[model samples]
Target: MRPKDEGACSGDGMAGRIITVAQQKGGSGKTTLTANLAIALRRKGFTVAVLDTDPQGSLGRWFMERLQGVGEDGGLEFSTSSAWGASYEGEKLKRRFDVVLIDTPPKIESDLRPALRVADLVLVPVASSQVDLWATEGVLDLAAREKRPVMIVLNRTRPNTRLGAEVAAGAAALGVDVARAQLAHRVSYAESLGRGGAVAEGPAGPGRDEITALADEIMAQAGIEGAATIR
Candidate 1:
């Protein structure tokens, strides 16, 4: 992918695209996606910043571990904010980064609007389960009200399984755009995050490929041009 021009704006006068990863269901891989996607974007030659709006502070903890392990942030900036402060903090980071990703807490309600309102795109991760699919409604409804574009990502899927097929079909019925790229059940994702790094930093494998594809698709959905081709 070509590097973004320094003066390129998000077309709304913002210097960067703010992508809020939200899901009402807990354990939907919100922080995992945020951390891995941040690393993926950085590798694609885009400066990225991650904003952790969840009170749980999981994303913030991961960044701290990454700092300790690597002794540096690897050009990826990180910060924390309250649910209400997401807009302010995210916008502030946008000025200096190519992408700003907000990792929101579980449970969708009025509190999620502040973050959704400021997003160029809202990414909803739905794990391969009927329960996970059901939990996505509140998030989809909220994003619809905010008029933000949303993409459903199938996460932790078990390929070639009946349950996986069922969940994929169920997600399609929600009338939202489901990403063609899906993240499978992989120990690499969890193990890497435990070390404050991403699967992309490890040897080339399916885990890295899944993240790269999803990142490219997300950039396309956000109307950003020149996403890196899958390696």
Candidate 2:
């Protein structure tokens, strides 16, 4: 189904919301979150696509594994590229799809700049650790300079920990919006994605609730109105 914002034209006159998933730090579950969010949004009856601008191509590999039926129904229909020059195609995909999630490289200077320039919303996934939180500052700085609306999604957060709160506050201090719900450090999230399916498509295991909750918080922050067609 087309997104409700279909009439709104992008900078190139396309109709879609370009959400860039980025963070300067590695191993913070950037690709994992991007992949799952693609599925979550698609399951809600909105057409979704992913643009992997990372040199590592982790998101692209995940898509390949998914197509082989190694994982759950990602519900995303899209492609991956190593550079932003393909953005014309990316914009086309967005117009054809409801939402386009851009998975950017870990560095903010090179590959990420172009995508950020065209993004409607930027989702920076942060892990719960001093090193990760500290590392987030660089990316946040870049986003701030770009003047893009940045929202922090705390990934792999441990419950009842002062670190989580500290991270959230630190992000807010930077004037970045931090989603109230955070993704837990769960084996199910890893295992589900390993099997080529997002947590939403995996068995209703231990981490299912956490993934769904995270999805809900993201939708709220993105200004995605109305009830989602829960899968």
Candidate 3:
């Protein structure tokens, strides 16, 4: 039997662009990246929704905390689903929001395909270590198979370090698009996430700037247009 048609949005018109943040290894900061990116986009006046497909439920937990602490999500919507259920839930979300960010679980191989199929752009977060770089291969290959556009995001990077430079070069050598905006290793990223808030909520700093630049790059790559002025 043929595979069921998993609807994929072309990111045209008003359909929300679905961005799946996938990595084969854990601790690559996928959840952190998703949460922060959602906030950045929301600040740009895009209605955002985050679909957490990771079994760990980190994103869901953060959203709950945000609700408790802030009494509102600040225009961000949150949902949870199994990895396989991402396509269905993601498509539904795309209709109602300007951007849908899917956070996938670690080490999910074949199960990652459904999410990839629905993604207009797949963001693979590679930390500043060779181990993290090595772990990204599986995800890169899978996204390639699905013919999804991918951008490698260098997360938790340390500045002025040889290892950081090497990893950036190595990522470029992979022949995939690497994001120019790299997220530095920042304590604020974790502290804000723990509070169900993002760096965007904090005072202007490197963390906020990094996420904003990356979010802008992602919007361009996803072909999303007409972003409102950043508040």
TM-score per candidate, chains pooled: 0.92, 0.85, 0.92
Score residue 54 of candidate 1 by CA lDDT: 93
lDDT of 3 at 97: 78
Q: On residues 1-231, what C-alpha lDDT tens digit does candidate 1 reach at each position?
A: 234443343344547789999998899999999999998887777778899999998898899998899777435788888998999999888877778899998855877998999999999999998889988998999999999999999999999999999999999999989999999999999999999999878898999999989988998888666645334
Candidate maximizing lDDT: 3
Tell me the tens digit of each residue's lDDT in model 3 across 59-134.
Answer: 9999999899977743578999888999999999887677899999995687899999999999999999999999
**Model 2 whole-model lDDT (C-alpha atoms):** 0.74
Of the candidates numbered 1 and 3, which has the greater lDDT value? 3
Clashes of 1: 0
**Lowest summed lDDT over 10 consecutive residues: which window, candidate 2?**
1-10
What is the C-alpha lDDT profile of model 2 across 4-80, one tens digit per residue?
A: 43334335554767788888888989989998888777667666778887888888777888888854333466576
Residue 64 C-alpha lDDT in model 2: 82
With a 3 Å backbone cut-off (N, CA, C), the pairs that clash in candidate 2 are 70-195, 71-195, 71-196, 71-197, 72-196, 72-197
User: Which wins on TM-score, candidate 2 or candidate 3?
Assistant: 3
Ranking by TM-score: 3, 1, 2
Candidate 1 displacement at residue 15 in angstroms: 1.1
